[model samples]
Target: MTPSLTEDGTLPAPAGNVIVVEESDMVDLFGVWDLVMVVSGVAWHLFTVVIFGWIVLRRHHFPPFRTRNLRLLGFMLACGILFWVCQVLTSLTTGRPNLPRAVCVLISPWLAYGLGLDLYMTILAYRLYLLYWLLVLRYPLRQSRRFYLFPILLGVPTALVLVSATASPRLVSTTHYPNPGNCVYSLMYSALCVVDVMIHIIVLLCLNYLCRHIEATYNDYRETTFGSIAFILLTIVAVNVFIWIGIGPPLYGYLFDREEYLAQFCVKLAADGLSCQGCHRRVDGSSSARLSYPPANPLHQHQYQRPTLPPGTGSYGETRPNDDNNSGQEDGRGTPGCSDSRTNGCRGGDDSLVEMAPTSRGITQQPADKNGHIEEWSLAHVAYHDDESNQLADKDYTGTSSAPHPPQHDRVIIE
Candidate 1:
């Protein structure tokens, strides 16, 4: 009778057309595959990290990676780095004695549970937060008290997935082949995906509604950024399904079942980078960030004496008088620029290379109001600097800058 097992300790292949491969040779196939899987995954994580860090250091980021956002990003990157560090340790213990593998197994789950899921959950949570801002709150992303909801959004789903996955027998088991150590698929991605799908559905519905809402409320807002955000999020969930379907839990049943942590982290890192790029891109192109909006009620248009602008100042640069309104409310908000201290002087994200408008002034924000209400009802569109000559408008025309402000015939906005 043919032996049930091969010499090097793996199940024997089928006898007939299988061509009777040697036990050692066939068993080595799994070890080699694992080596390749990990090397590729680790290398991918490192490449993305280096590339991502370079972008962070060299280029100005939008939303300017500061305040709470900055802290979250810093922690996110740390998670990725530490993930691989733990992975390397766990992997080295493979094929070693029980104590080393046991020690690695004990620590690796918690490390992954704590750090590995953060970026993934944050992506979902931020998406939810964005939907809330656009739909329910109607607040600017940069200015939302709803930031408090973020912890709940992030923590609840992550903890449930971890808890559920660990409870399931499928969480961690023997690696394929004769590998003795219990290596887990990435946080058992299958469990996390249930929450992912639910959130994705809700986000898609909100975005669809937002496209219509933007048309009605804001002047000249585009849905391109919103569309891009939807696509990025959809891609995240879809890729999870693809990866999980392919190399499932660490088990021998599948032809090439393997570890999932490294693979999952690499995908998550790349997705986060794309999402960040999408956020920064919102400020560019024909975006109307610089222009102020008309009053919500046409009947209540506020007006003041038209401030003098130098003759050559771009035609579009001058503010329009409100329709059918008496002049002289005694402008509380002075003309915006360096000339007026009372005005909201040119201010915005300090890290602003990526946010330059056509004037190249970079991204800018209106000064916060004293009553704590943001008067910038216009999206407070990006604040812009008038041409050098225009800043001297209050001065004599003859004293205008020698270079002369050119007429902005090319620049036009439809009221």
Candidate 2:
């Protein structure tokens, strides 16, 4: 039997309020669906923490912490931890009625607001980083971490929590279960969600503009393997759009249906997953390093042309003998003082000069000059031989000799 209103017109306190409900009643009110969603949200947050923890452990010794991507990742990881803590507290305080009203009222709003701010800052930071990279072609390294971190991490969230705590009727009430309905805090939460959606829309538009600019400036921009910043932004926008439409006003749904809050958690997980993957890909140099382009210098464009030989000539520009007509041509074993077209010098059968071919191995044998002097070859063209081998003995042919000397020794000639 509930108490009736007094003659003074004061009504009886509501039984459904969190402050009056017993632990047993609270447990029963939490249906199976609620428990499932809560558990899943908690598990997802734990998974996020583990993933980022592993990343930190692996990269702790490296200089990656200074990079924009890692800084963003660090912020996400911190936010995930805070969010996980909040979820765990919600599960405990909402389920166990033994918690003091003062403690719940004090901590709950701070945890919730801090979580929201963390997510907001992560998206904001990543968007700004992308803009800097695209427009300036450099990182925002000069900006101190405190420049962004303090405002997002501590200052804004603290102020919001304080404002909500002071102005919200439910949050300041002494009830065991203060309902977060029709309060300043709820309005603030709704405004935050709206702001999130708006920011995402702005980011999407900016990304489109940047993509168009890249295409207009670089003829082969599409062929480049730039990391998927546009794709990541699109994904984030889609997630926010789905939340805005499907969930229908986040704060209202979150206050009435706890499942909507779970959906928010899921959205956070999705955004973090996309960001981590995109940032990791960019940092690893896998995506950005694959852009191919033509050489800058024209000389380098023809660095590897095929070796062209003179007409009616064999390898090394040596004249090929006509088989049918042996006019004044010596036998295969030409004697000393014989003019052999193949040798381009006087030759004898012993240690005969053999014309060498230019191999595909970048080895070339220059033709003798009109003064009957052998042209110099680079060391790359010279082949080496062992001293023990007597196949072709070394002979100094500096001056004219009637007897054809063997091809210059295998000793490498620099020029």
Instruction: Give one digit per residue, the lDDT tens place, for model 2 in 1-415.
Output: 7778978888766655234543356453467866787779778877877876776778655654434356565676666567666655565555444554455544555554445444645454455545446454544546656345533543443466556665665544433335431112245555654555455445545544454444333311342224346757888997798677766765665577544333333323332322112211112344211111122333332222234434443222332122223323443433222345633443322223221112222222233346644333221222222222334322211112122222332111111
- List model 1 lDDT by residue over 1-415, tens digit each: 7567778988766544323323353222237756786789788878877876775676536543331244445566677667666766666654432332234334455465445545544553454455556556776766656676655654666566556545554654444312333355455554565555466455545544544454333311244357558879999988797787675653342234222322222223322332212222112343222222222343433321233445544222333223122122222232212222322221222211112222221212223245533332111122232332232111111111111111111111111
In TM-score terms, candidate 2 sits at 0.34
**Model 2 lowest lDDT segment of ten:** 287-296
Give the distance in Å from residue 329's predicted Cα in candidate 1 to where it truly belongs. 99
- Give the whole-model CA lDDT for all candidates, comma-separated: 0.41, 0.42
Best by lDDT: 2
Give the runs in model 1 whose Cα sits over 4 Å from its true position: 1-44, 61-114, 127-136, 139-147, 164-415
lDDT of 1: 0.41
Residue 279 CA displacement from its true place in model 2, Å:
59
